[model samples]
Target: MTDPGAYPNPGQHPSPHGQPPRNKRRVWPWLVIGVPVLLFGACGVAVVASVAGGNDTTVTTGPGDGDAADGGAADRGPDFPGKLDDDTAAPAGATITRDELAYTVSPLEAVDTVLGSYLCSTVTIDNVGTSQNDFNGYTDWSLQDTGGAIRDATFGPDRPMLNSGQIAPGGRATGSVCFDDRTGAAPGTYVVLFEDTFSLSTDRLAWITTL
Candidate 1:
């Protein structure tokens, strides 16, 4: 028989079916000690893993630190022709010559859409001669279809206006043509024309088409 209030006999373990004597020391002390130790060990492992993962490593390269050597030596000279002197003479038969006029259809090309569409054309006149040339009184600019049907064109504010205006040598003037009305014309080859009063000549500038 065992006394209820008495501790179990020394060197004799009591059966678990009987109520064990209470440990006066609070069990919360072990919980507090174990939780902090486990948390600290987990934090230490996390820090070690972060450092070992090399998440902070960074490499930097300076101007000349690569396999390719710096080819930009100070002694290297320009590969193209430099500025020409004012006294330079023009080549033979180059008197007041006009360059091949260039025209562009914007948005550079045509747009393909099931609905309505619009596009602009620009003609660039470059004065490559040594002397200034007057561009005044140049008016008739139009777009024509392949079948010889002429499309009426209007000049916007950016169009080349001669009104006694002169473009200096090496200067350029841009004339714009916009097409909004599409009645009989479908997507096909078209020719843009620029007629000037200076020489009574007409220039078939560009051949473009729509999608």
Candidate 2:
């Protein structure tokens, strides 16, 4: 005969209030614990790997091994030709003397249509001296327009006296000569002459004409 406390027969249903059989109970306890533990372990490994990699990195400093030298080398370069050195003392050259001052009407001259005036020709003075000298003198300047009429020329202050009254030996003074075109002078060659105030040299002359 079967014992009364024994499990129910395979064909019989369980009592309404009784618990289910042991093997039939849900077996998710290990899954619940192991899944979280595995995830935590993976996260810990990732953090540790990140920290270890960061510590292994190195930062290099200072100039690159192939870099060129500093700019100090260029600062010690060659000196100017006429400049004086600290230990060397030399006197300046002789005083500049003016021989002849002459100018020609440059081909680059232009006329202002709005102002109805001709731009004065560019006058170039040649230094016919053998040694360095200074220039100090004044001369009246004149300009000829397109017509045969002659007119006086005026200078702007910006083009102050050449060399401030001092011309280096063999150096020439050059400035613009501005004049009005109202003289009805035809576009042609113009003569420029100067009377030196210093030595009363009346023969100093130069010429230039319009193209």
Candidate 3:
């Protein structure tokens, strides 16, 4: 007969109700696998939330419709040409003479457009310099509203556009320089700026006026 002392008695590992202890090895493997699965699941959720949060804070520019409806009026850079500076600002109807060129701007006249109105100013440029001076209204002039939005010179319907060409000394060129103010968007004061290519001056001429 086997010695009862050599083999442990089943009563030593009995449950509270005296039943035999069940094998827990199978449950331990399942617990180990489940814990890692739960940890990975939590990590995936956190990563998705982080990605979603990043997308919510992105910034964009231009109109709500994503089109340049105002002729790119609101898309000015910090170094945009024809900005005012010291000794470069003038009032409306003033004849500013610099580098032998006399620039006179009259009060703006509102020319109606299909979408909005055009603020057209009669500009007279007198070439008093010894040499002929070249002028391009679309390329060398810009208009700025009180809100700091700048627009390039544009042509209006049934309006006389400014003539651009070489002006002989003692000669004058006069016409209308117009800016399209889409749907009265710019309804306040406006500034007419001229890039002085004659002097190559950084501080361009600015004539202040209102609508």
Candidate 4:
């Protein structure tokens, strides 16, 4: 004794499949028949999308901003210090022979994956200052790519940064700094940027190099 109008009145609008509308069919058998089919349909769609590599899912998939065709020539390396020398202890690398301090980046290596890609190098800071020089290893360096992306040194399990400490006059400190690499359209050149102080300025030391 069911009130058809108050419940699922299939007599008014029958399901296209001729099955009772779920609300009208409030029966355990119907629930058991419906739930798994719904789950299976959802799973099937997800599987097909993944296999097709479709970006329909929540995770994003697309090119980065720097993926321009001109090889990031616009984002080329920063300017090297005017005092930098072409030949130094590391002929294949760069040396900034300035008045107060001499900074060197050498033993450069191109690292792979790294959660991505990046340029790896050891930086040496020599204090030619009149007094002891305080140095924060990573603060003294930056990496710029051809795409105009300026990156700071990354320190993690993937790459450990140099220790920050003080160097007496004529003393030197060495540490590692990494600049993240962008894939896709980019120029072959990159610039190593450095500043000896906490203040910001256009006069930071730079070394133009390639990867």
Candidate 5:
């Protein structure tokens, strides 16, 4: 107020009517910006941590992984490794054993002899029948490829045929079934079939599964 061109003294500026100005540090700027910035950074970190810790992985079943069924020709509701009796035709009195056998199929990831492109799986068969019948891994089982091509079952030299002259009733057999997709095991649905004998009827066991 004394001199309009003079600058104010340090920390004490001239106020209106010649009053002294109050001394105060500049902090409101930092409080306004810094507090929100810190909160935003914390929330961002929390979101990243939640995403990293969440279990988002899925275990996919490859061509021949997991349970194998004995589905009929088409995917007629759970035709995998289960009973294959023809409900339509049973031997009059004995209830015609139909296909009283059950099978489990597990995919074989890598095999020494199996071609790199070929798909392989292990089959476990449980014969619940009362009679002793033969089991042939190769001639008994079959695979349907993505293109609807039927591939015959075969094994490497080490893979033994799941057989004995007598897979007695209640007997179990294990064998390996390999398939050549011709185009490799592409992504799609494949069907596995099993029959004690290669008969042309849908009475055999069939399973529909994805690759």
Candidate 6:
């Protein structure tokens, strides 16, 4: 028989000085793979943290911001409620004046229409500006009830509608502005808000009266 102790067993190697046989597998290959896996895990965690931080960012706006004074409706912020909030409430028949423009609104009157019923109010717009200004009754006026509900002007009534045209300096125009008569004949608190889009002023006029 061949010399049995001359070579070690399969998958093992002899050690010096008759020490235990060593396994053939080397640890370097496992170390190379494990190192790359650890690095990729750390990079994934960092990417997730960065995305989470970006989602936490926020933006805010205030009254004194230049958006209101600078540009048209497109420049306004999403929270802009079509009118400014600082306008004080004036009683009916009171002349509330804005930049070079004066306004007077009368009490509400009920009118029946074939399409529907409506509440009408007479408004007088006096242009005291140095230059001529245009007033559009359809887009310039709105009414708010005590419940914070806003109503736009409706042309379904029989009364003479507000004149929409250019007014020269030191001139005035008068006519009726009507709204859907949601509240019955009993008078309810109403607020009339007027914003002259033709003028550069962002300020609006508000009149509080019974409808």
Which is the better candidate, 1 or 5, if ranked by lDDT? 5
- Model 1 lDDT at residue 41: 100
Residue 16, model 6, lDDT? 67
- Cα lDDT tens digits, model 4, 65-168, are 23211111232223332323321111224455444555667644677764776677787777866888677766667776666677787763366566688889
Give lDDT tens digits, candidate 1, residues 95-181: 112232212233212323454443345445556567776653234455555454665454334333323366787787655555433
Distance from true position, residue 150, model 6, in Å? Answer: 0.5
RMSD to the hidden true structure, all candidates: 26.8, 31.5, 19.7, 19.1, 21.2, 15.9
* Best of the two (3, 5) by TM-score: 3
- Cα lDDT of model 2 overall? 0.40
List TM-scores for all candidates, in order.
Answer: 0.37, 0.37, 0.55, 0.49, 0.47, 0.55
- For model 5, residues 59-112, the per-residue Cα lDDT tens digits are 112334432211232322333333345412111011112345545666433344
In what order do the candidates fall by lDDT, top score first?
Answer: 3, 6, 4, 5, 1, 2
Tell me how many clashing residue pairs each candidate has: 1, 14, 0, 4, 14, 0
Q: What is the Cα-based TM-score of model 6?
A: 0.55
Which is better, 5 or 6, measured by lDDT?
6
Q: Write the per-residue lDDT of candidate 2 for residues 33-69, one digit (tens) a residue.
A: 9999999999999877654441111111122522122
lDDT of 6 by residue, 132-186 (tens): 9778777888887656678787784567789589889999998998888776545
